[model samples]
Target: MLPAEFDYAAPASLDEALALLAGGTNIRILAGGQSLLPTLKLRLDRPDLVVDLRKVPELSYIREEDGEIAIGALTTYADLVASDLIDSGVARCLAEAAASVGDLQVRNLGTIGGSLSHADPAADIPAAALALDASLVARSEEGDRTISAGDFFHGLWATALKPSELLREIRFRMPANGGGAYEKLRQAASGFALVGAAAVAEMDGGTIEAMRVALTGVSSGPFRLHALEDRLVGETLSEELVREACDKAGEAIESPLSDAHASAEYRVAMAGVTARRAILRAAGQWR
Candidate 1:
């Protein structure tokens, strides 16, 4: 496949990227190029300008500051997986999701920011982000703004990011050490999640005090299962109760996506199955 001819500029700084973005329409921002490059090669898009942010060093960091883990948008999945800053339950869930994307090479090349900005409903990172209640920081010529993970995804292959905005960083509150895990059924060919689930919990003896369950690949976007969390929280779990909550994982979606690899009914059913295993893994109830 051949791409349409387009003007390209690799910006050295965030300010330069912002100026390029604000200056015109049809100017696409390029992060890792894992998604956009494929779109371009397939002739799915024809943009007049491509602003590359690969050289912007400031946008590649993983650190703990304030009350959250500050992750620059350019922080690669490999970086997140290898970072010591990924210590807590929420961060561990994110690391597991990052590790699950593609293979080793893809993890090395794919940026967390790029992955989230692409907003593919099947991608694993979004479920982790949503489960951990992460916030995305965007920079534009106008100013900076923070978007909650719940508000960030507009729909399939869509996000709240405007054309003029560059995703700067992602931050999530540091969860105290407890338990976290991500589980998914992957599409063999693309390695995209057929249905992905992430769970983060704060445990008190045999009880869960705080918990979050999020899912991807089953709907138009990733989402938290608040009702399921409500049912699990503050309860001393029995296998029966955990099994019941996992059955409701599909309830996170208003509508499930049916694609060539999976039917919506199959995905919805897998949603409950996978989430059950994921929650069990997080709670140390199952191996």
Candidate 2:
């Protein structure tokens, strides 16, 4: 299927892009077009203008600043996977998730911001970002506002972003004394996750100090299992404990979706299995 006819503009500067968006009511910003083009082709979305951000130089860099890592909104998954600045456990998990999105071609063309903005419950980045405690910086005619990953995702295919706002960058505190991993079950054809888990753990003197667990593909949005986090912290990091924690985490999730590929019960079971595996991998329990 072909996308509907629409005006296209590749803006070289942020101001130009912002102005283009502000000038039109039915305008969609195109980052890599990996997600948008398909939606457009399917006629799920129709815009009067497609504002391309590929020519915006400043929105494509990855850098470390202060105590956090800052990734530009337009940075591709391939760029994240190849970046040297991303060295910590959180970074590794995020990079792995990026690599796992679709395929090599999609990774090279898909932007992190695009993935987040699309807000697909099955997308890996939102869960990974939640585990990393990432924050999004959005800009608009009014000003800039920072949104935590927890608050950024509102519901199925929905986000906190206003029509006039543009995502500028993502920021997250660097992980230390910890490691992370993301585990997912993918659809054989599309490679999108049917169920995914992202885990981060910090160890202090053989005891778990801090941990985060997030799940995707089973809910309206990526969600963190805080009840499970509380149970795991201050406990000895062991297979038994991890298994129990995973079970509790699965139980804590409110109503996961039952789709054609998997039932709600199956997704919940897979969520527990993946959570345990991810936690073990992040804790170096797997060799």
- Whole-model lDDT values for every prediction: 0.87, 0.87
Model 1 residue 50 lDDT score:
93
Residue-wise C-alpha lDDT for candidate 2, range 102-132, written one tens digit per residue: 9989999999999999999999999889988
What digit string (tens of lDDT, one per residue) describes model 1 on residues 182-209?
9999999878999999988778888988
Backbone clashes, each candidate: 0, 0
TM-score of 1: 0.95
Off by over 4 Å in 2: none
Backbone collision tally, model 2: 0
Specify the highest-lDDT model's number.
1
Looking at model 1, the pairs that clash are none
Candidate 1 weakest lDDT stretch, 10 residues: 84-93
